[model samples]
Structures are given as C-alpha cells and as structure tokens.
Target: MSIKILTILTLLVPTLSAFSQEKMVSVNGVNYHVLTTSLEQRKPSQPVLVFENGMGMGLGNWNTITDSLANDAPVFLYDRQGVEKSEMVYQQPTPQKIAANLKLLLKELKIEPPYILVGHSMGGIYVRAFAGYYPNDIAGLVFVDPADFTETKADWNQIFRTIGVSEKQIDEMLIKRLYTPLKVDSSRYAAWSEGQVLTDLRKTDFAELSSLPIPQVPILFFVGGKLEVPMERRSKDYDHERFFEVKNSSNMLRWRRFIHASSKGGALIYLSNSGHFVHRDDAAIVIGNIRMMLKAMEK
Candidate 1:
C-alpha cells in the first residue's frame, strides 16, 4: 500500500512561524487549512513553491525546510481533507481527485501557477499526478525521497534474490515493514483511513498518470542514503544489512532513470547522512536545490 501527499504554497516572504495565520479554504463544503507567509505579492509568472507532505504526514513535517526557504520564493502549505483543520467527507479520493482539489484550493486562494512543486515521500506521487493532469501549470519538480511507484514487484524480487534472500524472507519483511503506525491508527483517524485507502488503491488509481510520460520540466530529486531498518525494528525474518544495501542501490538507480528520462533533465543529489526524510535530515541541501530550481526557472 502507498499513501498520497499533502500540499503547500509559498510566496516571496520573510521567515515563517509554525503557528501562523492560516486560512480555512472551503472547496465543495470541505474546509482546508492553508498556511502561507504574508509576503508582497509577485506577478503570476513568478513560480510559487508548493510543498507536499508524505503519506500520513501533515504540513508541519516541512517546518524545518520551509522556514529556511524564507525570502527566496513564495511557499504554499496546506492540509488535505481529513488532516489537521481540514474537513474530510465520506468518499475516498484518488491522486487525480486530490490534485483536482488542490487546484481548486489554489484558485480559491487566488494563487497563480508556474508552480515549483516540492514533494516528499508519497507527496511525490501526488505532485507527479498534478503535473500529468496540469502540465502547463508546473515549472519544476523537487522530489525528496519520493515513493517509487514506477518500479515493479518483479524488479524488487530480483533485488532480494541477488542478495541470497528467499521468497519467504522477502514476504515476511514486507509484511512487517508495511505495518506502520498509520496502519494502526487507520480505523480511528480519518486521515489515516484516507491514507490507507490511497495506499491500497495506488496502482489502480495512479495507473493513468504513472503511465504518462514524465513531464518535461526542470526536475530535481533529493535521494537519501543510509537505508536500514532501525535496530529496535530489525527482526530475523530478513537480513537488515542486505536490505539496506539493496534499498539504497535500487532507489538510486530508479531516480537516475527518472532524471535521464525527464526532458529538461535535472540533477540527482544523494545525501549519505540522510535517511528517508532527506529534507529533514539535510535541510541545507534541500533548501539550496530548491533555490537552484527557482533561479533556473527565472532564467
């Protein structure tokens, strides 16, 4: 199962605080919590930085990164339905639907595009869906250890097999690893429920967009290193050291392919000190690359 991402919007502004003045944007009766810096408005042509959160995460996850991005460009951050102050209705939404809702929210807020989308984890997939659905609106993309939806199960199986891991071992590791805190809270939390549904139906719901060619935009990927199961979480079902090696190599290869396939190809920065949350682990790197993308788009 895979989770989708949350959305954020940025503008040319000063530093931001965690608890800033947030607007409750109403789109089709469901209210969304939108947190944006109060900066002098720029022209519509200037690309705004839109940050999306990983699966089962909220806009707060970006606090460290977004705070440093101050005064560079506009940043937009918002909670999707069922998260934070945002209200969720009963229906389950696909990535396209979530993107559509995001589009509507931007419109309601009067924020114009030529957007530089920054997505972490599952948010990467949502941003990709947005680019696929509204290609013209995107100016660039920054993926922070995004979920690899393009890879097939067979591909991973081969990776495990090469390390002398049996099929049963692979299955056990996956089952255990997939049982995250989000899964535990899904029955009680609306956000977790939506996240679970999105993850479960990711292949089916994201099939169309994922099948589309990679968007021809200035793209950047912030891939992490140090892929290992935590000591407390490690089990005898799989070899933790081997899994770490395979995960790191496999993800790097995939991201490289993505960068090469992009029309206006971008750079792939690997942070050895970082884990899955690259932005959180190495804030300086993420901020610098985002600045680079913004400057490139300006040209």
Candidate 2:
C-alpha cells in the first residue's frame, strides 16, 4: 500500500455520525464533538460506557462496538481537542490534561460516573490517567492493544532478532514505520504530530498518575495475537508478519503486568484472531468480553 493509503487509514476524520446523536459540547472554552446513544436503556444506578479512540482517530472508530453495546448500556464517544469537529488546542495535550478535560465534559453533560472507560491504543494511556486521577469516578477499565510506555528500543530489537532481522534492519524498519511522514493536509499533520509528541513523552508524561496509588478497578486488557498491519505500514524489506508475531510475544509480558496490577477480578484476554485494532478485527470478542464484565459488575 502507498503512503496515501496509510495516511487515510491512520488519520480517519469523522464525517459521519455513527451514534444516535452527535453534538458539540464546550469544556474549558473549547468545543468537543460527542456522539451518544439513547439514554433510555440506562438506569440511574448503571455505569456509562465511555470510549476513547486511538491516536488521530475520531469517535466513529467505536461505531461497531458501541452499536452492539447501546442496547446494553449508554455509550459515550467523543473526538479529542484536535480531531473531527473538536477545536484545536494551542498547547501540547498530555494524557493528564485530556483526562481532566474529559472529566469536565462529562460533568457539564450531566453524565454522572461510575463509568466503564474503554480505550484503544494511545487512548488507553488517557483512560488509565483518568482512573488514577479520579478513582472514585471509574467502575472498570478496558484497554485494547494499549500503548506500552515501558517498551524500549532494546525490547523491540530483541523481538526483531527472533525473526533474524539485524539491528540495522530493525532500526530502519522502526524509523520508516514511526518517523515517516504521510502526504496529508497541514491541519491533519498538525493533529497527528500532537499525538506523536504525547506518545514520545509517555514515559515521563503521566508522572503524577504514576506517583499516585494505582486504581484497583476491574481491568480487562485485550492483547491481539494475530500479526495484522496495513500493507502501507509494512515494508518489502523484511518479513513484517514474522516480525509482528515476535513483537506480539514481547507485548504479552507488558500486557500481563498491566492486568495484574488491577483488582482481583481483572483479566488479560488474548485474542488469537485479532490485531492491534482488536475491537475492529474481532468485534464479537470485544463486545462479548465487555458485556460479561458489565453483567458481572451489575450482579
């Protein structure tokens, strides 16, 4: 696949509303586009299911997962400050800032918590930060192929070595996949760069949350077992599939560490048929596991 394809797939802006209603809500002098399902199915005591999208992704990314979940509970999806209909921010947005903004947005909308926060990829970092900052507001957490801050160049190189890829080749592949620029509009580039900055700063960014006591909420971590990368993101220079398989092996240890830190009922589920976008690749599994968690919580 070409860079054009990669650009389209990676930074998909929301042009369509996938939920029952789409509206803009102001929080801290900025407008954020939000999509919500009907509230009729939700009870006063029930926890709201809130979803956070991956880097450069819009609320629409959760369309399939939320559609199935709408009947079970109220689902909330929103674009961050720089994506979709949301206003752009002048300052760098860290997970902590995003979490704080989300809290204000929820409060302004009168969506009272106990919330089940489901985050995919980079969004996982934000959800984790939210739970840390406001432990009382969250009931459970779901991380779908989350971004691992502890991942290092040495860890990646070790995984690539399993596929017989030399250090130089591994470095090259990493640069190409990570640092290469996509041919897109300046605005999209700006939005993507902001997210990239936060990812790069992940190790030191959530320091306050890291210092605080870990939230003991029920955590569900989904680690994708399949090696699934878009053709555009893959190179002909190496065995990308084999490399991804090895990388997934390395990620399992990290995912396990995350799940183990949560409450007794937390689970680390491995889906062999899924990829990084586990919710998209295997929506049934994502929906089923989340439904089970919700049911258990309800009991």
Candidate 3:
C-alpha cells in the first residue's frame, strides 16, 4: 500500500508543478497580468510573440489572435498597469516607462530572448521604445494602426485645448476612458473610471516620446482603412494634408524612411473594412498576415 501511494504521488508531482507556474508578475512596481498559452511542452524554436493592447484596452483583447498564433509558437498577452486585473501604480504612464516595465517583467518571468512585439495603436509606441531601448532583445515588430508620434501629439493637444481641457483633465479623462468598458466588467470599469482622474495630472509631452529611435527589425504595419475618415477629421487643417498623405499612403513613406534609416525590411498592409480594433474586428486577416510574415522570415 505504501509503495503504491508513493508511485501515484510521484506521477502527480510534475503535473501539479506545471500548474503552479504563475502567468502574472509585477515589474518595476507595476502589476502585469499575463495570459499565455503554449501548444507544446517544449520551448518553440520560433520567437515568442508578445501582444500589446492599445490605450483603454487590456490583454483580453488579443484572445482571438493569441489562440491562433499559439498553434505555431508560444504567445503572451498582458495588461499594463492600471488596466484590467493589473494593479494601478500612481505615476505618469509614458512610452518609456511602459517599455521599462516590459523589460523588467520579462526578466522576472524568465522569458528568454528573441521576442516579437505586436503592438496596436498607442501600444506600438511602447514597443518602439522597447526595441530602441533594448535592441538586442527583439526579433521583429508588427504595428497595427500605430499612432504617429508627431501627428498624435499635435492632434491630441489641439483637441484637448478646443474642448477646454487642461493637461490634468486630459490625463484623468484617459484613465477614465480606459477604465470604462466597451464590453462589460463591473469591477474593472469602476476602477478605471476613478483612475482616470489621477492619470490626467501625469500626462507627458511628445518631445520625450520622439527621442526614441525607430527599431531596426523586420516590421509589418497593418492599417485599418475604415477608421481613416475619423482619424483624418481629427487633424487640424494645417496638418490635415500631410496626415492624409501619410494615411492614404498607408504610412508607406514613414515606414520607408524608418527602414532606410535602420537598414531593415518592412511592409504595410491596408485593411479596407476594419477599425482601430483591427485584430478584434478582423482576426483572420491579422492572423493570415502574421503567418505570411513568419514564413517570409523563415526564408
């Protein structure tokens, strides 16, 4: 009887140990709640792709893409501080700060190198900063309708001023907006709503953001054409033409310039019927493009 019990216990130890591994961690005093899925027990040869959600979004937003990609390689998704299940730390959330947190998180979690960052909207800014700060850590980058630093800043300032919003108010609004759920989550929604007021007071400038260099990695920009009109309307008349030029070109010129400067290959794909939430709205398209990119990279 003792021998039989020892055999069962030994068999169950590995299973229990695997289940005990945590999927979340705190980096630089910020809580990052991560969701990960690995199709195989062994580490994959392909680089792990980390998905970063846009402002006001959480790791849960990438469920569809992560599910599809997990079949090929390990995939990870995480919510930034003050969002979703993550603990909110009181500080200015800039691209640089976020990048630092990511690095710390990876180190603490023991995530090996050769990472591919897939960032959407403002999340792209964070990834760009990350790549610049730790160039050796990245394998590639994919931007889904990322915000143009100069353009986004100018437009945001103007809009805020026009709406009679102070810098503090704008930050607060951002925090509130992020907390409010487009779908549903009563607890998170309330927390985000209250956190906005604190964030508004801590907003930073574009100059700080512009200091980061474009990464020298294979990149793919997936633009959503459906949101073009709204994005265009947000621009000032003086900046509208230039914004339209870049937008209409699917940001080809900017990518070209960046690629040339970095001496790396990059491409852009314009999706005609999607919005800011490209992955959510058209998961199949996003997944297909990534697969294609991966195949090309293999060659």
Best by TM-score: 1
Structural RMSD, model 3? 9.4
Worst 10 residues of 1 by lDDT: 1-10
| lDDT of all predictions | 0.74, 0.75, 0.63
Candidate 2: list runs displaced more than 4 Å. Answer: 1-19, 161-185, 202-212, 230-238
**Lowest summed-lDDT stretch of 10 residues in model 3?**
1-10
Task: State, as a TM-score between 0 and 1, how close model 2 is to the true structure.
Answer: 0.80
Worst 10-residue lDDT window for candidate 2 reads 1-10
Candidate 3 lDDT by residue in tens digits, 88-127: 7655565666787777766655677778899987777677
lDDT of 2 at 15: 28
Best by lDDT: 2
Q: Report the lDDT tens digits of candidate 1 across residue range 142-219.
A: 889887756655666677887888889777655554444343454446556556655554435346666766778878
lDDT measured at residue 22 in model 2 versus the true structure, 0 to 100: 65
Which prediction has more favorable TM-score, 1 or 2? 1
Native-to-model Cα distance after best TM-score fit, residue 35 in candidate 2, in Å: 1.7
What pairs collide in candidate 2? none
What's the lDDT for candidate 1?
A: 0.74
- The deviation in Å at residue 135 for candidate 1 is 1.0
Residue-wise C-alpha lDDT for candidate 2, range 203-293, written one tens digit per residue: 3534555665556778888988876568898867678888777777787786677667766558888888887899988899889999998
Comparison by lDDT, 1 against 2, better one: 2
